[model samples]
Target: MNIALPALVVFALLLPGFIARSRIKRAERSSLDYSPFGQIVTEAVLWAGGLHLLWLALAALFFGRHVQPTLLLGLMVSDAAAQARSISNLASELSWIAAYFGSLFAFAYGAPALIRAAIIRWRLDRAGAPLSPLLRFHAAPWYYLLTGADFPPGEEPDCIVVSAIVNISGRPWIYMGILDDFFLDPEGRLDRMVLEKVMRRPLDADKQPSTQADEELARFYVVDGDYFVLRYAETVTLNVEYIKLRPAA
Candidate 1:
């Protein structure tokens, strides 16, 4: 009965903002770890679907419904149907309830992302500069063999800048985040499972040369998550890329 109509409208209104926030977060998170694009997409879809269904159910309750259509049917068969006129009124009331619930659900899921995106987009565009191209590379599977050298020492930058130059120029490359802490084995060699996932192919490394343009970017600071600190380094270099082993001290 066109139940999705209002929900679709609300999603349309709210999607742009979420898209913006999603984009910036993706870029920022890309520095530390390979971006979790698939996971993000799945979460967003599930959130929207759950909210939509819940709202539809609420709207049905808000609008009045036909509790006893059979009474009118019986009266009609007996040539005493005088209350059939109320059927249209009941249907109309039910529709209003459905619409209300759909609108409410749409707003709940969409509002925050939209507002966050608006701010992000403003800061990004007003700076009048472009971010450098993302660097990427593939780490071979065998690098995970080094057992003890897995962790990097001290506070690392939010985006680990690897210095590996790609063989192919102008490819759509991105700085895949650090491969550290990925293989933590909570239950039986969890680290090994993660290592297998990342080792599926070559990982990405950042190789952009420092430039005046980077200096002007306000959003490019390296943030430290563990210590709650922001370390604004002009340039942090990785001597090797695609190695699962920790960097040489």
Candidate 2:
């Protein structure tokens, strides 16, 4: 390993990932802290996989190596071994710095939006209409994290409808909400404690119900779109609860 060359290669290899990891950490510190090992494992796996692909591609392109039948598998094993050693060393020496940068970057990019979404969700909860767990919220003109499926059109909605007006620069652009796949238990049942009502309304679409009762249901609102619109689509469900956030007051 040429000292300078390896150092440069390592920097090139790890700098961007480190920056990205930091950004995610800072932005979602609470979430990240609660879920560091999980996140790190996920990132490590993804990094390992991606690097394996890159290694193969480079070998094929530059070294003219035949992509054998077991090339991918071989790459994965080798990459894993390499990463295990590197991570252990880095954990001892550079883990703190790596974690610091990762957190800073994550906060810079991720925190604002998460904070906005939490506010929106809080407002929606206040308005008595909470969004279902499946719903997503975006940061921007609409600070809420309602589901993307709710708004078919790519228009950004208003956040103030649900909470106090917070000034955000730039035109309100739209992005998909963060997906929490762990919304439901393994048995496909909801945790009642975590579930709260944002908005409640009658289910009037299906009138021919003889067995199951047709009682009114509550659709939890997250943030409001342009003040507040309680219109519910068939596919969208409503439920509400405040996401725990310790944002700067």
Candidate 3:
């Protein structure tokens, strides 16, 4: 019974973290890399020590004068010695239960906020810029690309930006205007983009204004005056050459 109780307590204490790790692994697939061995060892020690201290504090609070550190110390000593005592009679059992459930509850409540904070910190670290409110829920790769740090001169951009050629259903069309907004899938890939002040010109039309033409298009050619949503999957190609043109005086 003593062996069983301590084993159960240990499992309960670690279960929340184990479940979190599993969920992160599943979510990130192989993209998540393992920490260094030294860092892993350090974190393991810190977690074990912190949990043990928390358990001790709970024991002192619950069992008070009856709580004996010797019982807990022996429980940690060896399997044989741990099995020697009857866990049911131990004054600290209630404290163990409280600590176990308390840890689980804390993790459940705080994990989402913690994850958000971590992601924000990581994005800031990688992009070397403050995170935009627009990207609070988006992921790293998207943030990096949007910040223009990932794009260099003469290179194909990772994302479709201001003005571009958007091929939809094999029909080539010129898309003009600001890329005002975008959405990301759970895995952080761009799902859809919203363009504002949008105008479209057929690829074969010679009357089309030069990309640098700042004059407003005739109302007839304006596809969407306010906004248009372009799905990433539906877009066959995006030519960013127009983005290099200087606006007409």
lDDT of 2: 0.36
lDDT of 3 by residue, 47-129 (tens): 54554566557656876733466665556555664645634346546775566567654654466456655654454333224
Which residue pairs collide, candidate 3?
none
Q: What local lDDT score does residue 102 receive in model 3, on the 0 to 100 scale?
A: 77
Q: What is the lDDT of residue 215 in candidate 3?
A: 50
Tens digits of per-residue lDDT for model 1, 1-249:
333443554565345334433433323122243437776556456555655455555545775432355543433342323334444444655665455545654566466456545643433222122421211111212222222222233322333223222222444222222334333222222232111111111223224443565442322334334222111121122233434335689
Model 2, TM vs. native: 0.26
Candidate 2 per-residue lDDT, tens place, 50-75, comes to: 54465556556875644343422332
**Who is ahead in TM-score, 1 or 3?**
3
TM-score of each: 0.23, 0.26, 0.52
Give the residue spans of candidate 1 off by over 4 A. 1-37, 64-106, 109-231, 235-249
Task: Give the number of the best model, judged by lDDT.
Answer: 3
Worst 10 residues of 3 by lDDT: 21-30
Task: Write down the lDDT of every candidate, Cα atoms only.
Answer: 0.36, 0.36, 0.54
